[model samples]
Target chain A: MDDKLMLMIPGPTPVPERVLQAMAKHPIGHRSADFSAIFAEVTENLKWLHQTKNDLLILAGSGTAAMEAGIINFLSTGDKVLVGTNGKFGERWGKVCAAYNLDVQYITAEWGKPLDPNEFKQALEADTAKDIKAVIITHSETSTGVINDLPTINQYIKAHGALSIVDTVTSLGACSVPIDEWGLDVVASGSQKGYMIPPGLGFVSVSEKAWKAYETANLPKFYFDLGPYRKNAAKNTTPFTPAINLIFALHAALGMMKQEGLETLFARHDRLRSATRAAVKAMGLPLFGPDECASPAVTAVMPTGVEAEKIRSIMRKKFDIALAGGQDSLKGKIFRIGHLGFVTDRDLLTAIAALEATLQELGHTGATPGAGVAAAGEVLNR
Target chain B: MDDKLMLMIPGPTPVPERVLQAMAKHPIGHRSADFSAIFAEVTENLKWLHQTKNDLLILAGSGTAAMEAGIINFLSTGDKVLVGTNGKFGERWGKVCAAYNLDVQYITAEWGKPLDPNEFKQALEADTAKDIKAVIITHSETSTGVINDLPTINQYIKAHGALSIVDTVTSLGACSVPIDEWGLDVVASGSQKGYMIPPGLGFVSVSEKAWKAYETANLPKFYFDLGPYRKNAAKNTTPFTPAINLIFALHAALGMMKQEGLETLFARHDRLRSATRAAVKAMGLPLFGPDECASPAVTAVMPTGVEAEKIRSIMRKKFDIALAGGQDSLKGKIFRIGHLGFVTDRDLLTAIAALEATLQELGHTGATPGAGVAAAGEVLNR
Candidate 1:
């Protein structure tokens, strides 16, 4: 009980001390002027982090709720939507759409492979009626450590006159995702990822184009309805009782992010990603995604001869480090190392050292002693 | 900002220091054994709090989300449901049902008035085909400070062979709501109200009858689906990333409640309610609801000649006390004082004193000095 494990999972990331303290503060009335001021600041800072001048609404649920909101709020039943599937999250978009009885055209790629922008373009070109209402893509697939090319796919969607809805759950604060620049109509993310807060709040930024669709979109929505959120946002309040403590934590976390600045934040993630990949490669483990398409938030490593679960167990038991296991079909095949949200160079180094020790303990002796640490050190020093 | 305001809103009540400190703890992996144990304990404690052996699942949203889940997961499109509407939350149930395209037969009562059980009984009796799938009622209508007769209405629902869905957001911990004894099919609540925690987590306890209805209910649901929640609950986990910090806070808050015991908790609320009503009467103000039907959680007062908004502003600006303003149609007509959750005798005395001063300051001199506080003290001493 005295030992606290390092949380190196994709989300439920390590929260900053300031954010935790902020959350610990006595709650204020949600409708009070003080709360409105805090909420307004959080909204503006979230916009700055997302690099979007769109309507970003906060929801009190997981990222999946935001994803479901993105789908149901802008499209009706039987509406044609082109969904791209490359990992668990990408497949989730299709499932959400199908649950709402949408007519879905799935564009899938192999797991750990990036979705081809040309495939989406071809699909749009083949739809002679231009009935595809929206094109949904996962910006960073946490499951397989792949970053889909959002700029190209969104451009294709724009050219085809279809709305671009993106799931930026693990990408918003880790890297550059300019919603307005990319012409993304809907971009959704969660607070636990890249925001350095615990999982409770979900955010979605909607474009003017998406609001126009919302005028007539006939999907059933109550709790996830963005209309009331938009209405309440004008007054710096939420339609329902929000997660007030999380909003306090978000305000503190966003202040920290503002102090760090976006460029430095992105570069920090880039450096950590590079250092982690260098360490994994030096340890003779195969990176799941191609180097060109790898995500900056989490890195999935495919063990050659050792059981992935065994390595994770060793890391948890001996090193007190919690690594993310693979999801869906990738379970026990690949283990993930997350470096998102409040993860520092020191933390990454510790994780890398633990991975090396665990791999060695599991009889994977292909790598030289201290090789992985040295590789990561060179990247960190630079 | 130096003067911390006392939060007296219906929800987002003042969180205890122990709960806040518990929430400030570091993040834990949701799938870890540590989190599982905490979650399982929280679930069991919640069941004890709910007084039911049913499946109680925690969700990361407001009470509205839990209400929506209760409606959508047990009824499909075009399913007829009898909805009782008295205040904002009651009307919200019908709106949620309407959003999901449910055939809602609304039994209406005026704001600040409790619904007549005969209306539901008559409506159910008139239905020759027995097609009313469920009867939804708000156990404690926060908007009007009215407590509906759940025991009586549920008896009517049971006799009519209809499921009883209850919204116990403001009633669960403040009063005795034994779901098993009351025969409630689905009882929903939120964390912030009576649980002495901040808002984020919504809970719903589903009975075996509701689970049977779930098998045939065809409403579209993803994030709020109880099927996955039930499957994961066996292992003490959630289908999505829960608001972990709130769960920690809930554990501490529930422990405090357990130590205090349920009978003591209900008596505390009852004492506070009596004190508040006495103070309101002593101040020569009109209580909104009938004395027999007033809620034990909050007391709504209809001030004569003085604007409710002005009183609230005075309370906030001068004394740093926040009293809840009325909602929707009741706005400006009534103001509510909440004494639920972690409120103490000193807090109630202070609120009463402040209310009297504010009323007098607003030129209402009907009441004598210290009369309200003296009345409240008499009740507190008992």
Candidate 2:
């Protein structure tokens, strides 16, 4: 009833009405002939979106589940994994690995900063015996709104003979992530972010190299057994019963994505990111991440002397616009606005206007109310 | 655009319009104040729906994932578990346990039959050393439409000092399952079944005994960690980025269930099931399971010499209805019609009528068009 509620979080972007209708339809047979057609179409579209020819499998879980699947499926217990830790999701990889009793080596960059490709090369070179089985990194760290140089780093890992697992949860469709070209062994993604569908389905594009690790690796797994999933997926069915509604929704969203074209979608996100950053700069808010590595999905703004929580709360309660505040050590320090999937320039303008009003209410001001929208409009119109 | 499509499969039932709209809303902050409110409300309702005051945690995964979480969280590699295998899902539970390297012993019932309570008692009594850490059973076997007697079986497990894990994926909301009173240590459910939502979210309610086993579990788990999930859930947040859109839809569906009251919902399912059985009998079709053990969620019919696949295909193409064919060896011999979640008397009558036409076209049957509707309406009206 309240269409005014605007979500500017990192994911679960608003779905189109058509996609919702498709999902809302009566549940189909997960193993039926009709669903097989739909399943094949979705798989083809997913590979197209990822720019890969690898066997893409869908899991009826969150993006984190796919990430965990990548970990346990590729590495045995006590196996060493090189984790790139710059933001929340990267740290999660390390923590999950540690929890699973893996020997974890964590490489760090400051929060809101991207990891260097040369540093990655150094880490791999340091492991002369090739103890490190995989290098795990996030393409877009939603927490800090930073996009690392995945292509270069993945190349480094490939050259050193270590597998690369990339978390493309936030950047898959919004940016050009060429999975095959980047030599990523396993790329994990969720439906809610760039796919413009409801959350519930996660996908992993597994390279032949990753599949090789899967055969000999010894770790506990059942529901996410990539082996059975790949085997059954050839017939367009899951090893287990899937979230059938979400699959229907995925089919619809993929169709829409195909119609829009991936290149055009990436360009749209690019323009949106540029406009949002320009507006933030126009409002005199310092950007959280380095300019060269800012994420296209979300923008993190560091408002001087202003508590991010207060601004987020006011925008949410007063204008029904939900913005994300910082997590962990950065809480109440930086606020983030998402302009990802299904997000248009008009939505960005709406968020900017709400942010402006909320900022003024919180007693921080450097620009007029209309200046943010106008600056963003300049890029959007072009 | 075709609103008349009937869902007679076990899961991914027809979602309500309100729930669909809720899911279509843009993704919200996973940890924001508003998202917390939603998470809190969904948990509260789920607790009531599960009929337990235990620690109920939500995972952004399918029912199998929740089952895996229950297994790996409580059992070690060499631990012994008693799995009751009657149909597909039960065998799946055993396979997953085996994959986890657990020593599993099976007490199997023939397909279309419930597990004998005495069988479980004998198994436990035979193991005087209490080597069996847990006993797993499916409350309602989706593959066979058999509802096992849980309360008596759980009592047997309790007397033997072993915990009980029940898969109530298909029966949680369709029938009355007094989880805490029945001593169910862990109850796993999915959204696509009786919860009246789409697939993707799996819920597990853990008892004190199960929580105690968690302290000693040495298996590999990270994203499905109940410890972190329980701790973060106290603050109404998930440890990882949640499937936000599905949660929104779940909240809406749960709200609708609460308004109707659980007891009434259960009773309605029971009546509809009775009428459906009467209709099948009147058509001279033999039911798959025993009358006393038939699940309220769905009815599996053995249509004599008629082909299940052909009946299913005719129903889908001509009547726009989807019926579930049998799995494994029973395939093409039996068909299932689901009456769980969001089904009304009118829906049942419509499905039955279409089934009659399809069955007759396939050169089988002895019933008039209105006989099934009449049988169902009599019970509903009473």
Candidate 3:
């Protein structure tokens, strides 16, 4: 009967009980005025979370769909674009752009390293013809636990007179990402990461500059068309039949976030991230990303002696805990501890305790029995 | 506490309580073994429901996205395609194809009229060079209660040496659609319509011939790419982070459908559609579409003396019943009564009674107070 597993992945984080209950309510007609009011309220709250007065549209898909919409809606075929890649998600943006026959100029950094703004600046400066239409960046690279310096990179994009498109999938609500203040032209995010809801809805905030670009952009789009979305959003509705139950869940989850307040929520995520990092360091494991730019949403740890998959398997089989393993090239080298969305300090302590037990069972007993929990507790107290 | 509204729309249909409870469970990691098992089970059940051994991939979006996927995956730019349009969803397919720069040859029919297979044959025979690459049709036009004859049209397509793409959004679980036997190349459907789940997930079944076409098709795609989906589906996973909670809900809903059996499910829908049509006739309202080609999922009624919107308003405001209004050119002229998915005879009777009373309130005194319900009951008894 004890089949409950704690989800600690980066995107599909733990959903609150209230939010789940809201989703379980009876289905409502998407065209009804009642549903339109609920949609309007959720849209306004999402704008508040993004700190943007720009147009925010809700799409029914993963974050990748939102990212694709941002690209296809504002750029035409054969248009030159600059893409910065330091992790898996960043590389995905480059691939999406390339899929539409866009001339992509990629500035890639090694995994686990923060993206340098100077690289983008140099690329932008080299475009003497001013042919580059947009500059794309990822705010939080979930694969390697590095938070790119969006503020600096966006400034370079602005100086070069190119539109700024940012992927805030893992950082929208987990930290302070002011889209308006940063002058981000198009920012895309997902629901399951920081909205404390299940995965279905993707969101995008569009600036006035991006909308103007959309008028001339002709890269072939239908389902992900922003024009229809913009027209319907003014009436508090979506162009297509949206994920209605997910929208209900989002309304409830956004209310909970409003009650907790954005400042308090960001501080809470920061505290949990600090505790997770402290616990990992105390366990004698090396952190993957740089100490200065660690992501508040998830912490990546490099297990020295044991394979990361083995540790994850042991944790799941023994303690019913689900942790995300490294993706792509970093597969057996690193494991991630996600503290995003509805995570608490106690949950982090429990995960750390499970990690300690799992490490001991693997015959890698460098740290004390309760060292990880103790370190996390010290950080919580501070 | 008495705010429970019955959803009678063609989509976002009434979700079963069991499916809702399944969706209320905590989120799971998309890459974990637990999710893979659920996903594999759901995929197999979907294949059974589709009556096809073809590769069926689930995308996280509305049915429109699946329709777009069917077009963009199997045809390149400027490819000639024949589109059959009788209603809103059919025209949507033509619009989607045109958006991608396809040379669309549309065979148009009046609203509420069934699409003629002879027209398609004529169109195909005229293309002496066999230039047409695909033939697209909507199996169930939700905007009008007309189920186009797909089996016959697909035969014409096969004889013409062209691929056939079908949109069965509101027909898959409501009636029999043997994709393999019908020789359908691509079939797309949505979750909310007949899967007894909420909106979000879109399913597309691709035949082997379509796979061959995909190798040479040059249309642009990223998030809706079927290549990665086929590669990852072999391992019981999706290419991107799917709508995890909706997949869980679909798993439970498909199990319920399996228990009910396809024969019984089709009979149930048939019975509901018959009773609904009888009730509307008893209430002195004319049916919109031809009686022989009426959809088993929903029934469209044409009011004689009163406006359709007035009746829908009265039903909603007084009885807390939400009926679907007409779309596009049929607005305020026809109201649809949906009996798809988890609907029952009792629900149909209640809706009929509400309609009768609303008609009386609107000063239409031709029918008795309980005439609609009585007629429906007699049909159910037979």
Which tens-of-lDDT digit does each residue in B1-382 have in candidate 2? 2546778888868788898778766666676777899999999999999999999999988899888887789888899999999999999999988998989999999999999999999999999999999999999999999999988899899999988888999999999999887878999988888988878888999999999999998887888889999999999999877878788888999999999998899998998899899888776678899899999998999987777788888988898888888889898889999999999888888888887887778878566656766776777788
Candidate 3 lDDT over B50-135, as tens digits, reads: 99999999999999998899889999999999999999998999999989999999988898999999999999988889999999
Which consecutive 10 residues in model 3 chain A have the weakest lDDT in total? A1-10
TM-score of candidate 2 relative to the true fold: 0.95
Task: Give lDDT tens digits, candidate 1, residues A326-362.
Answer: 9989999999999999999999999999888888788
TM-score of chain B of each: 0.99, 0.98, 0.98
Cα deviation of B232, candidate 2, in Å: 2.3
Measured against the true two-chain complex, the DockQ scores of the candidates, in the order shown, are: 0.89, 0.60, 0.91
Top candidate on DockQ is 3
In model 2, which regions exceed 4 Å deviation? A365-382, B1-3, B365-382
How displaced is residue B36 in candidate 3, in Å?
1.1
Query: Can you write out model 1's per-residue Cα lDDT over B1-382, one digit (the tens) per residue?
Result: 3547897778789999889999999989998899999999999999999999999999999999998998899998999999999999998999999999999999989999999999988998898798999999999999999999999988889888988999999999999999999889999999999999999999999999999999999999899889999999999999888999999999999999999999999999999999999988988899999999989899999998889999999998899999999998888989999989999889999998988889879999778978999999998998
Off by over 4 Å in 1: A1-3, B1-3
DockQ of 1: 0.89
Q: Write down the TM-score for model 3.
A: 0.99
Task: Please report, as a residue range, the 10-residue window in candidate 2 chain A with the lowest summed lDDT.
Answer: A1-10
